[model samples]
Target: SLTKTSGTSSRSTSQLGRHFHHRTPGNFLDPEVRAFLEENTEVISSGNLTPEIRLRLLTPRCRFWKERADLWPFADPFWAIYWPGGQALSRYILDNPNIVRMGSVLDLGSGCGATAIAAVMSGASHVLANDIDPIAGMAMVINCELNNVNPFPIAIKNITDTKLDKWDLIVLGDMFYDEHLADCLHHWLGKCIKMYGTKVLIGDPGRPQFTGHSIHRQLHKVIEYSLPEPTRRENNGLTSSIVWSYQP
Candidate 1:
């Protein structure tokens, strides 16, 4: 039942393999992108969350240049860093393996691939790391290789429109950033649960879109984690995060 009936997934994964040059590490995606990451990032095993995985994340010294300014605001450079919501979600899944074990997981808005990596490490049968940004997908691929985990499939497109009924679970970390996106996910995910009984887990550090409205009432707080020093710094001093089981 975890099988992807959507034909788009196959093509999306294929697109990730296109134009792959000689690899610096892992499957070659883009030589220039890989070079940028290699020069700017270091492989980190963030034991604060999932000690079993590693990621190639940006260094504090890495400069954000004018060339990439176009990507700002929309395709945020924030993907280069792990946020508080993702850190807590990853840790929860790792600690509670029965939640995702042998399940099909979709990590939506999967910045830095932290949630997807945790799902794989926790024994998910099928895990898809999805983001509209191809760079994030590439980053996910590299992280998978660094962890020496199973193959990671990525969908380099927006999936918020889809019902995603076939997936056993959908894990969203720090997704409620704006009202429009929040509305879309609230509708889409609510339908998924009603139609196919898809389970949803949301990790949030109290964004307005999540906590500022009635949507907060629908969520059942499952667990909470006090973010590590680094995560707090990246996330505007959010001291802690809560993992909520979305009961829409």
Candidate 2:
């Protein structure tokens, strides 16, 4: 079923779930939402993504962001903007295509699908995106289309509860924002490493929840980038972001 993290009514959820049919969300998009996003969001590229990864992203100047609750009373529009970490990671993927060549990749919490699109563009054999927010899930499909991604699919739920192994690589960007979510990721990600030796990559700008986790001991920096001017402005005054390799 389409996961509902907010107070949206069951009737409303049923209306939404009919598009997904009680499974991980795929390419299905409600026409109203497709039209709304196409109308409200702006087409732009992320920080330093060479060859230009275009995305339909929301800005504060948009109507929905300026008056969110009044305009769209669902979840916060986390997917509307590409987070700083995701931006840096997407650039890294474009610069270092060999890392994901012919591999299966999962872009966990793939808000805006920037990193996922990079994986596709970089030669990944297959790529799947996962995010809990249904709206974010829809936006990712639109983004993949914006980037001309190959037949993209998104699993629209929190998947941290599963052992979740077998991915050739799993990537996360700016996902370490919540305490409980951080702990769950620590346990689940550690098992993925120890049990399957799956490669993991993290892109972050030192969110407080990051260093406090057990996952901290396993990460080492691979590359860091100074944030582009526009990304810096939105990243809570952070000047840079880092991509860390996880080897357990």
Every model's TM-score: 0.82, 0.86
* lDDT scores in order: 0.73, 0.75
Whole-model lDDT, model 1? 0.73
Model 2, stretches more than 4 Å misplaced? 1-27, 46-51, 68-70
lDDT of prediction 2: 0.75
Q: Write the per-residue lDDT of candidate 2 for residues 49-155, one digit (tens) a residue.
A: 33388888777667765652433534556787777788878889989999899999999989888899999999999898998778788888777787787756788
The residue-by-residue lDDT of candidate 1 on 33-95, one tens digit each, is 777667666777763465566777765555543234432322344567676678889999988
What are the RMSDs of all candidates, in order?
7.8, 4.6
Clashing pairs in 1: none
Error of 1 at 105 (Å): 0.8
216 Cα displacement, candidate 2 (Å): 1.7
TM-score quality measure for candidate 1: 0.82
